[model samples]
Target: MRLAGIHHVTAITADAPGNRRFYTGLLGMRLVKKTVNQDDVRAYHLFYADGIGAPGTDLTFFDWPVGPRVPGSHDLVRTGLRVAGSDALAWWQDRFARAGVAHGPVEERDGRAV
Candidate 1:
């Protein structure tokens, strides 16, 4: 069978708490699950999502104590969220500004906001 859209995205975070605060507190996601990494018992695996934690909306992270990487052009380019309309985009822009979160302007990319 062909694959549908992305169900979730997972990334590594050196600070789980900060990640949680940024996603859940600032971006208004819910903490769907809080559990330890099964393979590496000492670390945490966090799942954040929209209000009810729907499958396709899940954004997860693994709390590995990795040191910071030097800023380079070759790293993962960007992570984007698809907001429903221009209103939602404006809301996010305002929210990010009020929360002191750095964010670039919402611009049209391939006929959609990115």
Candidate 2:
């Protein structure tokens, strides 16, 4: 099947409030939607993204309290956000640094970053 782009990426989280704080407050993504998971009515499904809740910009979480953490097995992978250009990368790097968020040093990649 051909895909135009990603709709969203969903992840499991243990703490809903903490997740909300990190994504919305710290990361500066808008809390687009707050809802209950369909299969598990009590659990939450949170969506965060830029303005207007645009697709491909969303980062979603499913509250799964019983799930145990599994480390060192690639269970968690990094998510990369694509910025507009070198200027955007520079601006983002500065913003992240000021917020004390640890991120990789900016580097030239495919004619971007620089």
Candidate 3:
């Protein structure tokens, strides 16, 4: 089966405020919604998407606001999101560096500098 592209991706965040700041304020993604978790009233469900989300540009989070998950489901090592091109990557790299956001040096992967 051939997949066109990603419609959305979901992840868990230990810090909802920090997550909101980073994804929306820093990365420029818009907050689509902020809702409470049905199971856990203390938790939150934060959804973010690129401006006027079209395709391949939605990120959501199930937040546990109290603290980091220990010995549980939050073990994802990395999540890759594609941008316009190498130039855009360079721009983001510069932005990250300037903002003190930790990021690896841009490297080529699958013939694309990421």
Candidate 4:
């Protein structure tokens, strides 16, 4: 069997408002929908994506106010999104700096500088 690629990724956020601001305001992603979790109506399930919220462009978040991770607990390490061209990385680097988003310098990964 073979796989094509990731369709979407979900994450937990302690501060939903801040997460929304960061992704939509800072990173320039569009909010596809603002909805609540089906199982837990009190929590927010925010879906963000490109301008039109394409299939593979989804980045979602679940609102959970768990205070910080306990020591030695398993946690999400990293998430990456691919841009169309090398120029996009350069643009993002500048955007990150301007928006005060901490990001590492683009380095070679899988034979491409991402």
What are the lDDT scores of the predictions, listed in order?
A: 0.86, 0.84, 0.85, 0.89
**Roughly what TM-score does model 1 have, to 2 decimal places?**
0.88
Per-candidate TM vs. native?
0.88, 0.76, 0.82, 0.87
Task: Say what the RMSD of model 4 is.
Answer: 2.0
Q: Which candidate is the best by lDDT?
A: 4
Better of 2 and 4 by lDDT: 4
- Candidate 2: give the clashing pairs: none
What RMSD does model 1 have?
1.7
Once fitted onto the true fold, the runs of candidate 2 whose alpha carbons sit more than 4 angstroms away are 66-71, 108-114
What is candidate 2's lDDT per residue for 2-69, written digit by digit as tens?
89998889988889999898787876789989999999998999999997788789889999884565
The list of candidate 3 runs beyond 4 A from truth reads 1-3, 65-74
107 Cα displacement, candidate 3 (Å): 0.7
Looking at candidate 2, the ten consecutive residues that score lowest on lDDT are: 66-75
In the range 42-103, model 3's lDDT, one tens digit per residue, is: 88999888898766788888886445545766577578877898889999999999999899
For residues 43-97, write the lDDT of model 1, one tens digit per residue: 8999988998777999888999876576874656367877889899999999889
How accurate locally is residue 67 in candidate 3, as Cα lDDT from 0 to 100? Answer: 51
For TM-score, the strongest prediction is 1
